[model samples]
Target: MDDLNAIATLLTKPEPPAEAVTRSRGRLQDRMRGRARRRIGWLLPALTLATAAAAAVAMLVTGVITPAGAPASGREVLLMAAVSAERTPQGSGTYWYVTREMRDMDIPRQESWTTRDGRRWSKGEPGDPPGVVVPDPDPLMLKGAEVSIEDLEKLPADPEALKARLAGLQGRDSAMTASEQRGDPLFSLITLISELPTPPEVRSAAFRALATMPGVESTGAVEGGHELRFPYPDTTWEVKLVVDPETARVTRTNSLSGNDGSVLLSAGFIRVTTGWTDQPPR
Candidate 1:
């Protein structure tokens, strides 16, 4: 159709012979061509404007805006497209959780628990007293049990040394025998070990720790800053960690990408602005 239009435009350029114009209904044909050109000229802008508007609407709805500089207060914000989950202060030192499930990934399942650090735990191990369950537990299950951040600190100060210990621990364990398996403490230990700023020798161990995590992938640095990317059932998300450079303690975080690659649902990013506070969410 475009080709035909182009040809018609070329043919009508000089309006044909004026003497040949009145011959054999040429005048009528010329009139039809003139009317067609006028109609096409009007339609083009309307279509272009409509296309631009649709693109703008899609961007707004997807939340794919360029993020601003990282926040200051050691507070963290995590977003999965328009849906997001945040850990904030409920009061001076206490924390709370707020999550918006825009994609319905079944993340806030009935089997959920809370950690002392204020993060929500879903799919815990058996008899484990309901903590976070590392979802993917193949090749590296049977580890001892979960432990706390403080407990991990009690272990070796060397990250490399600690990782070796973790590998050995996970190797001896077997699959859960019952619901009690859900409460295993290794998940907590894994979290602690992965988040800590360990020596280079232990960096591989941190990656290994993150690998055994049910839904977590890699925890490392990106663009010269620390980053953690985790996989939800339907989406994989990236987060930039905000840390106290001196303490190696993560102060806050920002979401990098939502739905980087997944089979289910819309695979795209949404943009949002957030602020973190020292206090916890209520």
Candidate 2:
């Protein structure tokens, strides 16, 4: 059809007005432009594939894509796990069954030296047993075989009481406070976090606390949200936590920044996909 049109144009010799010739030339230019556009459009996918291949090569050379979806250099594996049970009819209330695999660093058995707290004792040098050090039972265990927002509701609702209870925890004794400046800022900030509320303040107090911690970032939703971050140089030690909007209960919690993930250090939501199914404990 295009060939026929071209032959017809070549054979036709009707006298042409200058304006008509100009119009004919303009139409030919328009048709040629359209064809050029179609040809470019056909190359778009090839161009895109080539661009993607270049980016993949660049990332591979820069070590951005590590083994097993792990973050590249300067980042550490932030493994997390959460368990919730007894889904409510409204589909809004679910009991937080467990948030294990938190960070806890027990200085190597051999590296443990003791402090003179009324008596001199050795924590044992490396390669030696942890010695006669007694283990403090986890309070979370005694709270219940299963924990819920309702259970926390029964506790003293007073923030002061809550602060006192939290302050009494093992690491709290060494916790630095706002008044305890001049010392380690990290320890002081950790103590202050013990007073955090379900939906973080996001304003004066919470904002100020977050500022003191490093690598600490945040995101939120209309109703509720959280912020997980690390205050230290190491990426392995971090905090993860979430809250129940209505009851203000800590619904999800875990951490991975410590040597052994067991301690609740930071509080925030993390990106993950978890499923709920009742299965007997192994």
lDDT of 2 by residue, 109-210 (tens): 211111112111222323334554332222221111222223333433233344344334333322223322222333322322232111222111222333
Alpha-carbon shift of residue 158 in model 2 (angstroms) = 1.8
Best by TM-score: 1
Judge candidate 1 at residue 109 and give its lDDT: 23
Instruction: Return model 2's CA RMSD, one decimal.
Output: 24.1
Please provide, for model 1 over 1-282, each residue's C-alpha lDDT reduced to its tens digit, 9 standing for 90 to 100. Answer: 442223223322443344432341333333323432112111111112222222222222223221232111111111110111011111222211222222223333223223345353333223323434532221111233443324443554232455456444432224322211333333323233223212322332233233343444223222212234343322244332322121222333332211111012223211112222334322
Candidates in order have lDDT scores of 0.28, 0.27
| Alpha carbon deviation, residue 219, candidate 2 (Å) | 3.8
Off by over 4 Å in 2: 1-96, 99-154, 169-217, 220-226, 230-238, 242-282
